[model samples]
Target: MMKKPAMQKSKQWNIKGAVHLAGIFHFLHSCGSGCLVPFLTLYFRHLGLTATMTGIIMASKHLLALVWRPISSVLARQYDKRRTVIVGSLLSSALVVLLLLLFPSAGIKAESGRCNTSQPSADPTDGSDFTTLESINIPSQSNANVYSVNHKTIITEQPDELSSTYTPTLVNSSSNWSIRAIRSLRNLEEQQEEAPHTEFLGSLKVMDAQQQMFFLVLFVIVLWEFMAAPLEWTADDGLYEYLDFVDATGRHKGVKVWKQLGAAVGTGMVGILVTKLYCRTGTVTEFYSYTALMILTAPTAALFPLYLRKRERATSGGFKALQLVYGNSQALLCAITVVLTGMATSAVSDFLLWQMQDHNAMEIHMGISLALAYLSQAGFAPLAGRLARFLKYHGWLMVLAVISLSLQCLYYSFLWGPWAVVPAQMLAGFSTGALWWSVTSQCEDIATPGTEVTLIRLFEALSLELGAGLGSLMVGFVVQKFGLKILFQGISVILALWSIALAVLKWKIPRQRRINYSRLLAADTSEVSESESDQEKDWLETAMEDARQGNKWKMDKF
Candidate 1:
């Protein structure tokens, strides 16, 4: 008996240890991710990509995640979740390093100084203004290099033997020297093309190389992002599954607290690092290197999951076909609310930094804005959990979340200064944190038994990634056409409409019934004891009858 008790105690200890380890893994992983992801757009812009291109790249990242998450889910089930996490983390880290190496750091150099004279007297027949190049001064060339100046053209002297060398063909134009004229003049002197025009040709080459490098880097980042998706699934699904095993009702709050705290510290550290490094060096290359190094350590935390014993009830085997289990009208409303919430939050995240930059916010200011957003999110996540408990109904919590999001959107739309973003971010933090936790809990409640993790992953892929990807594309186009202020205003209006719709749905739908565990347990125990007592009474009666029969037989024999 004592041994049994001791074994039970040891098992509980191990379970607690595993839960804590999972939290640690989340913290480490989140910290590494927060460093570079928030500033991805800024990094791209620094490379001279336009807003539309950057938006497309960002949207592609999420779209890839949306497409691959199902595959990742299957893989996680086929292989050990721990092993999947470790492999994914390592692969993602390696890709990050490759991305950094492939990124085009050196931009195209500016053209050398050249002379331009006023337009020469127009010919009376044509009456068109035409500029003439009087004397050209190429900063890179020495005075020893011979150049002959014609009426309006400059030609470099070349050796007689090389004069007949093949020249690139150019279109014929009678107009004064332009980019086209430069192309035409190239055919006159082949040796001079290699000598005097090297800088121009080199600049063009660099530009082409940069464009290729940009696409290559984007490809690598996308691959890294895809590899990284498994870790997120493992962390979220693992935490919920672990909590279910331990029968911990407050699982979300407990795990989220640690994760959020780590996120806060990580985001703040990133802000500080970027501020100091960018201000000092005027480049984010060092920051990327540091992020890569930090991510390499993520596998260390990931290894802890290897020690976690898989739960018997956990989803396993090849991807099982999920049965469609529809919920009530209220559930549908909640689902829509979650999707819209995701869309609104993602829009803000995708563009808030760019908006700040447009307002002339410094690098440090941008960092602070992101830091504040994350820190506030961290603080509110636990609080949101508590609020959910008090509200008791998930729909009310969803409404609260939508209201918070709308307020944040309104604030951002009218925000005129940099510091004003901090408060707006606080609202955003509360809304997102609350909405995520609420939707997750509600989904767990409505999901068929043994399908909680699968449903949650599906919901994440559909609502979060899908909504985010679409929002990114939309925000990009809206910002491109309508401008930033109008974009936020539109978001605010959409969110406001969503909130009103959710409110009406809540009013029309009845509250879901809650289960009474204590009453059910009492009834089960009563039935079991009564059945046992009846069985004992029946056995006693049979024994008495047998004894009576034996006495009657002996009397008859005598």
Candidate 2:
């Protein structure tokens, strides 16, 4: 049996190792794939693409990513994870570097450094503004790479014979192009006139800046998956809230795209963090001891999963031992977890939105909401720890938390109108905090010993992303269709029903209780004569069984 000090050392090493590798992949992904989605629309516009065209491109990108998610999951399941991580990381990084290097400029260029495509040139009826051109042979070029300069639109071409080779096409034939050009110039003049009187938005500018900040933040704290994804999701919600509001005014579309980009990267970071944390630490709070059990297990749990083992052992050994009944039951539970957590979070933000009834108070709302949300996460950790002790069954604890928040959210949802959403923020605070506690702690029970915590954490990442994605879409739809009240009511009912289903499953399991740790370890040591294969299997089984039982008496009783 591993001694206490030795186990502690092992756990520390594991945590460190997982953090190191996870950080590297997280950095690469954040800078590469992470940055691309946000800047895509901006880049498209830089190429003079219309808003409609840009939107179509972005939709296609999202659709493709959605299509690829299942494929990614399958690859994760079938291939070696290390290989997958390495390939995805390198490829994503290389693509980003290549794009920036090849296309160094982000916007259009003109003969005059300051050029407006929307503007028409000065009147050329007289000789002063117009220069007569001799009819010359012009080389052929692709129309795609051309843009209008001064009074002429032109394309560049190379000649087969050498000498001088480029040509320009001037369309002065019917004056139809001139008519269109004059109409565009009139619109530009009108836009310039209206630019000053439009409503100035302090919240939106801050929101956009926050979005840009999150990208750098993800790169800085890529080591912890939990840090990136959760923070990013929350940050995205904040960014999106403003985007939704400003959509009412059409002028700020460019700013709106930037805000969404921030949200994506921030949320993506959160997803990465969740998975990495799970792989390394058996407990979610491996980095912190906000939960009592994490504190108890910190000595070993934090350090155990770090060292790189033979690939076979990391994958094959744990799978044989865990033998989890992964089917409809697990899916149902994961879904419930996603929906409840999502509903609770959305409700809180919805409440904040309602409270900020005045345009002037928006910044105050943003600051207050963020300060309170962050505080609640830190403050509620200990309370969650105490509750975990009272409710030993991971399933029951999760259910109770969900049901309580759901009912509370429902109450706030139907209370009045906009004012009702304000009081609901408390439920939001509690529910969001409670979710991290339940999901992470529950993961402790589910993960196999000798299995990389990365795998379980990856599941957590996926669930959280699915939750945020679904939640945003659902809340937006409900608010638009049946109104805010109906959305809250729907979430309430969903959470309550899901909780009961999970509670029922928990009762059915009837876990076989084990003795305290010292006695268990003593027994384990005595049984060392078992074959090597059997010994490893026995260790993995016992560790997980201990997590499920959460019977800390084993350590203290000895």
lDDT of each: 0.59, 0.40
How many residue pairs clash (N, CA or C atoms closer than 3 angstroms) in each of the candidate models, in the order given?
0, 20
Q: Candidate 2 has what TM-score? A: 0.40
lDDT of 2: 0.40
Q: What lDDT does candidate 1 reach at residue 155?
A: 39
Tens-digit per-residue lDDT, 1-558, candidate 2: 975654444322233343333333333333233323322333333333333333333333223333343344334334434233334333333323232222222123211222232443356442122122111122234233233433355333333422322232334333344444333433443444456544584333323222323333323223222112222222222222333343321121223233323333433343344334432331122112112211232232222222222333223532342343242354346445755575455444433233233222222233333333344544566577566656654455567667767876677555543233345444543665566566555444444443323334344444444444445445644554575566667878877787787678767754422223442464555433334336456767978998966767666677
* C-alpha TM-score for every candidate: 0.68, 0.40
Provide the lDDT at 387 for model 2: 67
